[model samples]
Target chain A: MSAVASMRDSILRADTRLSKYHPLSRILFYDDFDEGVNGWCELVGNHAGNLDDIREIARDFRPPQLSSCTFFDIGTHGSIEGTYSLKLATRAVPNHAAIAIKRLTYMRRGLVQFETYFTFKAEQTFDRAALSGWDGNKAPSERQFGDFSFSNDICDGENGKRYMGLVRYLNTDVDGNLVQKWMHKTSVQPTTRMERQGVVPPNQDFHTVNPDDWEEIPGGNQPLCFNETASKVNWHYLKWIMDTSRRRMVELQCNDNVMDLSSIEVPVYDGHYHGLPNLLNFLLDVRTRTNVRNFLYLDSVLVSVDW
Target chain B: MLRRSFTAVLEKNSTFTSDFATEPYEAGWALEARWFVRILEISPGAGLTMTAQISPDGLFWCDEESGPFCLNEVGLASMPLRNFGQWLRLDARLSGKNPHVKVLIYLAVKG
Candidate 1:
């Protein structure tokens, strides 16, 4: 039997190693980027389809097998360390930062967890707001994209709001059919709506806008201030869990830290017309221009479901 | 499962409101609902009070018998809507010192 078939059988029969811990089947899919990066495709703006472009980038940037394991070494443009990380430059052609792929049909009611390991390495100028030069001038204010993201078309909330906001979300229909729906702003904070229109209303006296130092209240969210690019060279483990059982709660774990993004609406978007979350993808985005090439090392992507 | 998303962006001390009109409930589909807050940006020591209200008519609204919640840190502040009526909306009131918290309150209802 094929590898996919064998794995599917093991999961369905509750014969996998994880079966010992949970009564339900686990490990729907696992990828070490060993299959030569053929499983993922590229997406830019709203145009999404095919895997040709992604394969090209992968082949050009693929590094030697890591001793006993195979992994993707992106952004190895003749660096002394060879292919060490995936370099997603804002200046690259197509200017796309996201990739798409499909996974097995895991019940939406079950807890879907996407776990991976990554490290972000960029020039000190990455966070220009800090200190770019001796003059101590702050960097321009622009929307920096997420370090990593996972989006599927299962959510159908708002269409037009996709491009205008930091993230995109398509609406899901009453019968669970996917549709492109436009949501209008009926009730919104006057100031936030104004800020969206390029106007900064006066700050509320009780609110502080900018702060000199940010204190991590002990158990804060993952990718906390300590995980910034300048922190360390150690690999970081990140996990995102979407629990649709009771209240669609999301738990994010960065190493030992945990952030419960409670009562969240649909966070992912699906420009693709597929009605299912077949587009279970892991993406790295760099929205602003970087002075030097940056890197993000990806390894061991996994997804588990209650069934 | 069927799910929908509703968002409310909060400002400092200002109560941001969002009204979500869902589709008529259909038989055979089990229903579930949750609320989450995505911290886009916030001022130091920011806290916000979130309340969900239900109404038969969009105009006349009352607190969701079981829907008042508060969140100090970022992440999901989820609550399941057990027995809900038709028209549902959320209110987020920023509080605390310099309580400038910019967060997106997302309401996910699934059946």
Candidate 2:
């Protein structure tokens, strides 16, 4: 309790918005997918294989490990009561498992916040393999998957540029200390390359900004790894705030802790000829299988506009 | 914003094209809106071409892009409709060898 209090005290009053604004829209259609994946569409060509992997878990299926976290409470209180959470996994083939809400039109540049609860199953453990190719048994060295953003024009086909909404990528360094990066696409354009058309090469039509170019989200030096560890099994609550009108990430909060990322610019669509994400869509991508048996549970998701 | 979603199925070896329009709005409003497209499900190794064309009068239509965007996976794709037109429809052609697949597309505009 004292630790949570200290974390709260550290976040300046100006950076906090949990209590001020009420949720205007859930944003995530079929929020819990209780409607049986009706409003969601898959992007992976292996749709049959991917669809089967996206399942739903009943509410009260697991205790709320994140009850003590303020951000967690904000999302739960704002979401549809007693709704089922999503269980997305990268099972069977190694391809990423993902689903996006069908409604795409939404204001990208606005005062908005996205909150959700995600955690690894108790049986799962970390397995660091190479970055390029998947090792049959383990995930790539860079565990940079989940919560993708092709929904916006950041993936404009013409320039092969990507303007992502939110990307959570985590990995461990040589010293075994957990290293994580949170990224969002700003209006800044990357140097263009050849556009060969459909499913072109990596950087061809979809320019992935260099890791160094991405704004860094500050995480305390403590090791925050999600695996078999009992304490870490608790749900990790995440919150993202953006002022699309200003085109920048206003702030980001993990659990009760808030960090000011006001310097990070939000992606602009002024010169993006291919188009931009006019819709507020979300997706899940588990690019690698954590273990022979493992699952990722999403307790809840809430999106609101305050301003 | 006014947002609506539509679903259609492309049977095996068949082509499907359906028309959907933006929520009818007053003049100069639709021009400020944008449209997003997502192909929900396509059978394995299925080659489906998904295209969005615009019509000012709903009689004559033109391709939104140079060629139809091919779908082989599950993900989100979008296009800005600064002044594209009033009516838009999806044109999908399925690769006969693959099984039938369902398509889910969403349209959103500023309220």
Q: RMSD of each candidate? A: 24.5, 17.1
lDDT values for all models = 0.37, 0.40
Q: Best DockQ goes to which candidate? A: 2
- Worst lDDT run of 10 residues, candidate 1 chain A, spans A62-71
Which digits, one per residue and each the tens of the lDDT, describe model 2 over residues A50-118?
433322210001111111111211222211223334444333222223333333545444766666665
Error of 1 at A116 (Å): 0.9
Model 2: native contacts recovered, as a fraction: 0.00
User: DockQ score of candidate 2?
Assistant: 0.02
The lowest-lDDT stretch of 10 consecutive residues in candidate 2 chain A is A57-66
List residue ranges in candidate 2 displaced over 4 A: A1-30, A33-38, A44-83, A91-102, A107-109, A121-162, A169-177, A181-200, A203-215, A220-233, A267-270, A273-277, A289-295, B1-111
DockQ for every model comes to 0.01, 0.02
Instruction: Residues A1-307, candidate 1: write the lDDT tens digits.
Output: 8998678667756844233222224776655442323244333222134222222222121111111111122211221122222323222222123233343333445566666554443323334444444242222211122232333323322231211111111122223233222121112112223344454343221011221111222234223222323323345566666554432436656667665545444332224233433223334333212233223445445667775
Worst lDDT run of 10 residues, candidate 1 chain B, spans: B21-30
